[model samples]
Target: MPYDLKHVFASLPQMERGQSKVISGDPKGNNFLYTNGKCVIIRNIENPQIADVYTEHVHPVQVAKYAPSGFYIASGDSTGKVRIWDTTQKEHILKFEYQPLSGKVMDISWTEDSKRLAVVGDGREKFASVFLWDTGSSVGELTGHSKHINSVDIRQKRPYRIATASDDTTAGFFEGPPFKFKFTIREHNQFINCVRFSPDGTHFATAGADGQIFLYDGTKGELVRALGGEKAHSGGIYSISWSPDSSQLISASGDRTVKLWDVGSGSAVTTFSMGSGVNDQQLGCLWQNDHLLSVSLSGNINYLDKNQPTKPLRVIKGHTKSIHCLTVHKGDGRSYIYSGSSDGNITRWDSDLGLTECFSGKGHTNQVSSMCVNESEELVTCSMDDTVRFTATGGQEYSGDVVKMDSQPKSVSASGALTLAVCIGQIVLLKDKRKVFSSDSLDFEPEVGALQPGGAVAAVGDAEGKIHLYSVHGSSLAPEGPLLEARGKLTALGFSPDGAFLAALDDQKVLTVFTVADNYSVKGHFYGHHAKPVTLCWSPDSEHIATGGMDMNVIVWDVNDEDKRIKMPDCHRLHHVSGLAWIDAHTLVTTSHDSTVKQWTLTY
Candidate 1:
C-alpha cells in the first residue's frame, strides 16, 4: 500500500463541501459560487467553508439559513419544495412540497428558539408560511403581501417578531402563534429582494430592485432612515447579509459589484467590484465573518477579505454526474459524470467544474453494477445488493429498498430516461422503479459485457457469445431483437464512427466487424494480437481504434486499412492495463486493476 495513488494533480483544500458552490434559489440571496463546484457552508467567520452542504432546490430559488442551534437548515426552491435537514449528517429530516403555483422562493428564516421556520416564496394562494420543522406541521400563517414575497427575517433574540420584503414594493412585519400580519410599510417602488434582522434583534435592513436601501427598528418595525437612494446601486440589488458583529452589511447586485455598508451611519464603507461585464453580475452575497463571499451567474464564486483584494483564497469546480446505473451524486456540480470501481463504489463527478464528489453519502452494500441519472438529477445506483438507491448531488441519502433481481447485473445502459439492466441472462427495463425490471425468464443466460449507443441502435454484448442490438422505436427496447452472434464470449463491443459497422472483440483475441443493419452481415475478421484482449476504445474522431490486452500492450489499429495494424511500443509502459479510453485523436486514458488511471500524450 505504497501511498496508493500513482499521481495527483493538485492538493485541494479539504473544506467541508469539497469545492462545490451553494446557490440560492432566490436570485437575490447570496450564491456561493466556486470555480471547481465545491463549497462549504460556514458562519461566524473562523471556518465558513467547514459546514456541511445542507440543501438543494429545483431551480435554486431561496436562501438557506442555519438555525440558532446550528443543528438544522431550512431551504426552499422554485418549485415550492422546502426541506429541513440535520447539519452533522446532512440528512433530510423534513420535506414540504407546497403545490399550487410555483414562484421563486425568495427567502427562509428561523425563529429565535429554532422551533419555527418562516418560508416565503411566490405563490397564488399564499406567499409565505410558518412551519414547525420536526413534524412538517403548520405553526403560523403568512399575510399582508399583495404580490410575491421577496425576503424574510426572524429576530433570533426576539420578542417574536418577523419581517419580510416583497416585489409589491413594501416590507411587512408580523407577530405570532398564528402569526398575523402586524404592519406593512409601502416605501419602495421596485421589488424588495432582501431583508435581514441584526444579531441583537434591535434593527433590520432591506434592499431591493429599486436600488434603495432602508433601515428599520426591529422591535417596533419603524423606518429609521434611508441609507442610499437611486444612486446606491447601478443595477438591481440581489442579496444582503449581516456581519457577525452586527456592525456591517454586505450587498450583491447585478451591477457586477459588491458593497459593504456601515449599518449605523447608513453610508457606504467600501466597495469591491469584479467588473462591469454581464458575466460578473453579482447575484448573491454573504458576510462569513471577516470575509465576504459573492456569486455570479457565470459560475464564479468570489471570496474577498476585508483586508486583501488581489486573489481568491480558493475556488471549486463541479460537474453533475451523468445519470448512470449504480451511482450516487456525492458533492455538487452543474455538469454530471460517473465513475465506477471494481469494488462497487460509483462516485458521481460534476463536469461543470471537474471535481469528483463521493457518489453516495451512505456506503454501498455491494458492488455497483449500473447507474442512471434521473430527470430530477438524482443519481440511482443498482448494486449486487439486489437493490437500487437514489442519492442527490450533495450526497444526501434517500431510503432505498431492495429489488429482487433474477441474477446479478451484467451490463446496464440508460436511454430515453429509462434504465435498462441486463442481469444474469434477462434484459429488464426500469422506469422510476427498483423492482420493475425483475423477471423469472426473458432471454439467453448471458452476462452483459459491453454497451454501445449509436443513432437509433443500442448494442449490448453478453457473456454467451451474443450481441443484442435493438431499434429504439420510442423508449422501449424492441421486443424482436438479436443483432448478431460472436464466435466466443463477447468481451467487448462498440459501434464504428459512422454507425455503419459494429465491432466485437472476444476473449480469443479476435476482432470482428459487421454491418450494423441488413441482418448484421460479417464485414471482416482481424486476427493476430495477444493471447487475450481485455478492453477496447475508439478515438473521438472514430478513425482509430485502440485495444489493451493481458499481454500488457496497447495496439492502435487503422480502421480504414486492414493491412496496416500498428502496435505502439510498450518499452515505456509498465502497468497491467485494465481499462482503455481514447480522449482525443492525440491523447488516451487508461486504468489498471492495480488501482491506477493514467493519461498518455500520443506522439502519433
Candidate 2:
C-alpha cells in the first residue's frame, strides 16, 4: 500500500425518531462508542476529532459496549450476532463471535468481572439471553417479559443482579450466578425504554414512553420511589445515566430537553433545553466522569454545561448521511476540506488539525452536486436545488449570494472571476457572483464540466462520451476546435492546476489525460479501477492525478509515466467512493457513501 490512512473523521451515529441511540463509555472514561450502519465508531471523550472505526460487522450494528476490564468490546447487530474484539490492538482482532438471538440485539450488558454477558432485543422464541463471555454457555434464564426487550444492565457490585426494560410495559429482575427471573414490576402503562443500575449497585432506574421514571432497590427488587413524582419529563424519557458518585442522574427526553435529577429529593436539579424543532428531540445520553453528553435526534452530540442550561458548552456536528461531494481549499497558510452530504449538509474540516465545523445559516437545500474554490477564496457550489451558492471560507458561513440555474446542476467549476455550471440541459456562466450567460439550447447533454485555470476555456463532458471544448469569451462560451472523444459516458472532468493538462474519467473504468500545450493531444491513458470512476482531482503541482471509483479504490496516476501509479483498494469498505480531492501533492482526501471523510498520505 503506497498510501497510508492518516486520519478519519467518522460519521455521527444514525438516528431514528422515537428510538433511543445507545452510547456506551469505556471504563477509563476516556472514550465512548456508538453504532453507525455496520460500523462501530469510538471517539475520544475530550477531543472527539480523534476517532477510530471498527468495520467487521456484516449487519447494521445496534449496540456496542466496552467490557468492564477495558480489554475488549462486544458489539451487537441487527442479525443478533455479537462480536467481542480486543480493544488493545489497532486491528481489533475478534476474540469471539456468537449469535444470542434470532433478531435485532437492542442492548448488551456485561457483569462486573466481564466474564458473563446478557443480550436482549426483538427475538422470535426468546427475547433475552444470558451466557458466559468465553464459552457460549447459558449462565442464566433471562425470561419474564412477553414482548421485545429495549434495555439491560447488570449490578456492578456484589450479589450481581440483572434488570431489563421491555416493550411489554414492565421491568424484570433476576438474581444469582445462574440467574433466574425473580419477578416483574408493572408500574407503567407504556413501553419501557431504558433501564440502568447505579454505580454503587444499591438501586436501579427504569424510564418509559409514558414519561415515567421508577426507582427500585437493586438487592430486593423493591420499588424505591419515582424520580419526578408521576412523570419525570413532559415527553417520553428515552435514556438515563447516573453520575459517577451515584447521587444524581440525567435523563434525555423526546421533549427536546435533558434533565438532571437529585435522587434523594426526587426532583429536577437542572434542565438543559436542546431546541424546539422536531430534530432537536433528545434521544440518548451518557455521564462520563465530569462530562455530560447527550445525542439529539439530528445525530449531533451536545456537551451539557450545568451553569448554562440554555446553551451547551459545545456541539459536535458531522454528516449523518452519505457524503456526495468534496472540495479542498487552501487559505491563510492552512488547508481545509469541505464535504457535502446527501442531506444537504456542508462541513469544513481542518486538514492539519483534524477539527471540524459546519457552515452556518441557510445554505443548499438539496444535495450539493459539485464544489470549487475561486480566486476570491470563496466556495462556489452547485446543488440539485437549482442554484449556485457562494459561501465565504474564512467566516465559515453562507454568504447568501446565489445564482439560479435553468435546471438542476450536474457540475460546477470556478477560476478567477469566472464560474461555469453545467446543468441537465443548460450551460450557465457566472462572473462576480452573478449569472452572465446561459445556453439552454445545446446539441449535447452535459454530464460534467470544468474551467481552465486561466479561465480561457470550458470543457463539458456529455453522455455521448465526448468532451466539448468551448472557448470562454467574456461571459459566453463559443464552441472551439473538434470534440475530444472518450471511450464511454463521462463521469468526471477536471483541469490541472497549472493549466498544462486535462483529465477525464468515464464509466468504462478508464482515465484519459490530454496535454493542453500540444493542441489538446492525448498525453496518456491509464487503467486500474475495477468499476466506473466517479470523481477525479489533479495534484497541486500538476504532476499526478487521483481518481476514486465505485469499486472503493483510489488510484494515483503519474502523468509523465503512464505505467507508474499507486492503487489503494478497499479505501472505504462496503461503500463506493463518492468524491476525491488533493490536500497537497503527497496527500489525498476521499469521501464515501459510508458518511466518513478520510485523509491518506501518499508515499510516492
Candidate 3:
C-alpha cells in the first residue's frame, strides 16, 4: 500500500476591517505572497488556486516580503521575529531568524541586491530597524517617527535609499549603505499609510489616510510633484503599486474603488468600482506583468480589466476565515467542489485544475454546518443561520429556493431526489425546496441525518446515542426498525455508497457500522481514535472508511479488516479537521480550521 499527501489549496489573505493588508509579488511576477494568522501563503499569480503555505511562525504573522533575488522569503510576525527561508524547496527550510522589533512587525522591504532589509512596526523603544539580511547585524537606525511605522520601501538602484510612512503623519527619507534618516516630509495632514518606490528607482510615492498622494525624487529624497494634486482617492488610500515601466500607478482605497493613474500627468486614467458594501472597500493591490490585482476588505481578490473598467476579468474568492462544510459534485464530464466558510461565503472549485469561482446573489449569512450533493447535481446546504438552501452545481449561485427552519439546521443528507435534514429536535424532508414530509414529534434530540443510497431509507442520529431508522415515503420519513444504540452522543453519520451499510461516529471515540439489510444492527465497531471524530467519508468501492478527529489525525480503515488502519497524525498541527470528502477512489480531501485544504493520494 502507498499513501502520501499530494497537493494543498492554500487559504486567502487574512483580512480584517479598518486594518491595512499587504500583498507582495515576486520579482519574476510568478507568485504572490500574503500573511494569514501564523502562516504565509504563496500562490501562483496565473492560477491563484495553485498554492503553498509556510507555517513555521508561532505568532500571528503581519507581513511578508520576497527577496529581490526571488530565492528566499523573509516574513515578520507579531512577536517581532523575522524568519528567512529558502523558496526553492517544498520543505521551505528556515535559514535564519532575527528579532527585529519589540512588537508587531507591520511591514518589510528588501534592497535590490538582497543584502539588506528594513522592517517597521510598533516597538516600545524604536518603531523600525534596518539590518544586513544574512548577518542580522544593524545596518542603520530607522527613526524620526513618533508613532508606529505602517509602511516601508527600499530603492533598487546604485544610490540605494529608504523611506517609511508612519501614523505620526510624516514620511521619512533615508540615505546610506549604513542608512540614516535624512529628512521628514510633513505634507500630509493625516497618517501616511503606504510608501513605495517606482521600478526605475527615479521616483517614489506616498499615499496617506488624508486621501493625498505625493511624488518625490527617489535619489535626491526631494519633493518631485504631487500626483492628483489635491487627492488621489475620495477615501483614505490603503496601498499603491507602480507599473513595471514606472510610467503609471494604481491605488487601492477605502472608498471601494481601485484607480489607475498616469504618474506623469497626475490624473486618474481609470476607476474601477468594486462594490457598494462595506466589505467592498479596497485594502491592498499589486501591479505585476499584465495583471493588476486588488484585494477587497472581504478578502476577495479582483483581477481588474483595464479594457472593461466596470467589471473585472475574474474575482478570486475563498475564506479568510475557517471553513466548516463542503461537498463534491461530478456532472457534465467535470468535477466541482463547493465549500462554505464560517462567514457564509461559498466558493466552487474545479476539482481537476483547481480553478475557483465564487457564488453570486444572496447566500447564507452565517456558518454553513453541513452540505451534500443531490440527484439533480445541485448542492443542498444547512446553516447555523436557520436556513437550508439549494444551489445549482454548474451555475455557481443559489437557486433562489430556500427553506426557513424553526431551529438552526445541524446536518443534511441527500440520496437521489430525496433530501433529509436534521434540525434542533425534528427531522424534515423536502423535494425541490418544498416540504414533502415532517416528523410528527420527536422524543430524541436529533443531531445528524443521512440518506441511504438508492433513496430508500433515511437515518437520523440523536444525542441520546440512538440511530432512528426511517422508511422513505414519497415526501416523508416513517419510523421503522429498532433504535441502534451507541456508546455516546452521535456526532456524525454516513452510509456507504452502495447503501449496504451505515456508519456512525459518537463523542466516545467509537465508530459503529451497521448492515442496512440486518435491521440496522451493529455489524462491527472500529475504534482507535484518541479523540472525538468529527467527519467521515467512504472510499469509492466501499472497502475503506476515512475519518478525521479532534486529535489532529486522519485514519483510513479497511472495513473488512479493522486491524489494517492507516493513521495520518498531526494533519494540521494544532487544528482539527473540520470537513472531509473523497475526490476519487484513490484520493481524499480534508479541510481544517487552519484555513488549509489538503489532497492525499492512495494506492493499494
lDDT of 1 at 232: 68
lDDT (10s digit) by residue, model 2, range 399-489: 8798888789988999999999999999999999988988888888899999999899999999989999999999788999778988899
Q: What order do you get sorting by lDDT, best first?
A: 2, 3, 1
Q: Per-residue lDDT of 374-406 in model 1, one digit per residue for the tens?
A: 555666566776655555544434435334566
Task: Sort all candidates by TM-score, best to worst.
Answer: 2, 3, 1
What TM-score number comes out for model 3? 0.94
Q: Tell me which of candidates 1 and 3 scores higher on lDDT.
A: 3
Q: RMSD in Å for candidate 3, one decimal?
A: 2.2
Model 3 lDDT per residue over 114-187, tens place: 99999999989799999998899999898899999999999989799999999999999999979998999899
How much is the lDDT of residue 433 in candidate 2? Answer: 91
lDDT of 3 at 114: 92
Q: Highest lDDT: which candidate? A: 2
Residue 426 CA displacement from its true place in model 3, Å: 2.7
User: What TM-score does structure 2 among the candidates reach?
Assistant: 0.97
The per-candidate count of clashes, in order, stands at: 48, 0, 0
- TM-score per prediction, in order, is 0.51, 0.97, 0.94
